[model samples]
Target: ELKVEQNPLFLSMQEGKNYTIYCNYSTTSDRLYWYRQDPGKSLESLFVLLSNGAVKQEGRLMASLDTKARLSTLHITAAVHDLSATYFCAVDINNTDKLIFGTGTRLQVFP
Candidate 1:
């Protein structure tokens, strides 16, 4: 099986709302990362989780990694039209740079 899974392949959220996306992995990994991509643009780094219980946040987005459970979460707060984008989580197996990415979560922030 592939290494990663993300829930809610698509999400439509209203402005001023909150949501959380979950990412689950099948194997042990050394690092987990979250990225966001605007329409027609490359992904921009959101968070990099290096160890168990590592958590990071920026603006309205927060990400956490639990190595022991092989899980990661990206929480979105106060949705806005500007936040409409696709989110992806990736895992670096055994500390290698080659990351296996989740299918992705497409979020639409309704105005």
Candidate 2:
């Protein structure tokens, strides 16, 4: 068996920025997967590309993309810790209509 953990979400950034979205999975699998989510958008797949060298993304989680290179990396490894939380937006009805932050995480693990 392989140790596993789940965390939320993804982000887009320019240069001189850090990546907070962490990835974790077994290191001995024959295949791997990497996913991300953008604001105002749905889940997106960073995998499944066509050629090599051509790439995409907006954050420090950057890498080359080319199917020919078989180098279309999936980046399946833990970043820092084994757990993470993605905070969301919420309305604080008690603070005179103040705004607060919340976390809603959904983990999908296959056994």
Candidate 3:
């Protein structure tokens, strides 16, 4: 089986609201990463979790990783129209630089 899983394939939020996304993996990995993609835009790196209990944040988004449980989370503090996009998390396996990505989380932030 592939290594990663993410819930709520789609989400919609009102402006100024908040939500959280979950990611789970099946195997041990060297790192986990979060990325965002806006319409017609390339993927933008959000967070890189290198170790257990790693957490990183930028703007209104925060990401955390727990290797013991093989899980990761992305929390959105407040929703905005500009934040409407797709979010993805990936796992970096031990033998390869390639990442196994979640199906994707499509978010719509209504203004």
Candidate 4:
């Protein structure tokens, strides 16, 4: 069975501060998987990892993965209220279409 775990399930930080969210998976996965969701909103793709050591950044958010370690990280720099949302990482099961998502990390950014 494939499983994904996210660290710091809940985070509350002041605006301008920085933080990181981690995702660890139990097995090898074939593609990219990062998403965000605001309250009552649909999920949004935030990052896509095509291979080990892949990294992507947009605005104040950055994401990277280490396939060898089965670990991925989403880092927030100088956070703002707009960045507050639930973040998730998912993995394909044995190169199949089946996916398993991590327990989301709900972040709250206050000014």
Candidate 5:
């Protein structure tokens, strides 16, 4: 069975501060993906870490995956209130496209 765990289920930071969200899985996975969802809104794709040591960055957010350790991280740099949202990490088990998502990390940034 595949299980996913995320740390700091909720995060509150001041604008321009930095923080990181972690995701760990119990088994091997073919790919790791990240998503963001605003309150009561649909999810939006963020990054897809396809290999070990893979990293992707966009704007103020960056995501990396370490397959050997079954861990993925989403880092926020110079956070802003606009970036506030719920972030999730998902895994494609055995490349099956069946994604198991973490509980989610709700981030709130204040000025």
Candidate 6:
């Protein structure tokens, strides 16, 4: 079966604090994508990991993939209130033009 899972579904982070979000998959895949969303807003693409050890970063967020272990991670550095949002990781299983997303991680950054 193909599945994706994210731990710590809800997160409350303090300003200047750092944290990492973990994502695990149950099947082989060719690509993975990371995205961010604000309340009532559409998702914004953050990273795309296409191969083993692939990584992408933007600002305070970094995302990586390890295809061998079917794992991916998103790390946040020095979080800020402005970074409060929900993050999602999706996997393109079967390379069939479809993406199955893991349960989202909602983060609240406070001062």
Counting clashing residue pairs in each candidate, in order, gives: 0, 3, 0, 0, 0, 0
lDDT by residue (tens digit), candidate 2, 1-111: 343233454433333323333333332222223444444555454433223354444332343343332223323222322112232222222234332222323322222
lDDT for position 8 in model 3: 82
CA lDDT of each candidate? 0.92, 0.33, 0.91, 0.90, 0.94, 0.92
TM-score of each: 0.95, 0.30, 0.94, 0.95, 0.98, 0.96
Predicted structure 5: lDDT? 0.94
The C-alpha stretches of model 1 lying farther than 4 A from their native spots are: none
CA lDDT of 76 in candidate 6?
94
The candidate maximizing lDDT is: 5
Q: lDDT tens string, model 5, 1-111?
A: 899999889999999999999999999885999999998999999998899999999999999999999999999999999999999999999888889999999999999
Per-residue lDDT tens digits of candidate 3, residues 1-111?
A: 666889889999899999999999999985999999998999999899999999998899999999999999999987888889999999988848889999889999898
Candidate 1, residue 101: how far the Cα is off, in Å: 0.3
C-alpha lDDT of residue 80 in model 6: 86
* Tens digit of per-residue lDDT, candidate 1, span 5-55: 999899999999999999999999859999999989999998999999999
Name the candidate, 2 or 3, with the larger lDDT value: 3
Query: Which candidate, 3 or 5, has the higher lDDT?
Result: 5
What does the lDDT come to for candidate 3? 0.91
How much is the lDDT of residue 29 in candidate 2?
A: 26
TM-score of predicted structure 3: 0.94
Instruction: Please identify model 5 stretches exceeding 4 Å from their true place.
Output: none
Candidate 1 worst ten-residue window by lDDT: 1-10
Give the poorly placed runs of model 4, Cα more than 4 Å off: none
Model 5 clashing-pair count = 0
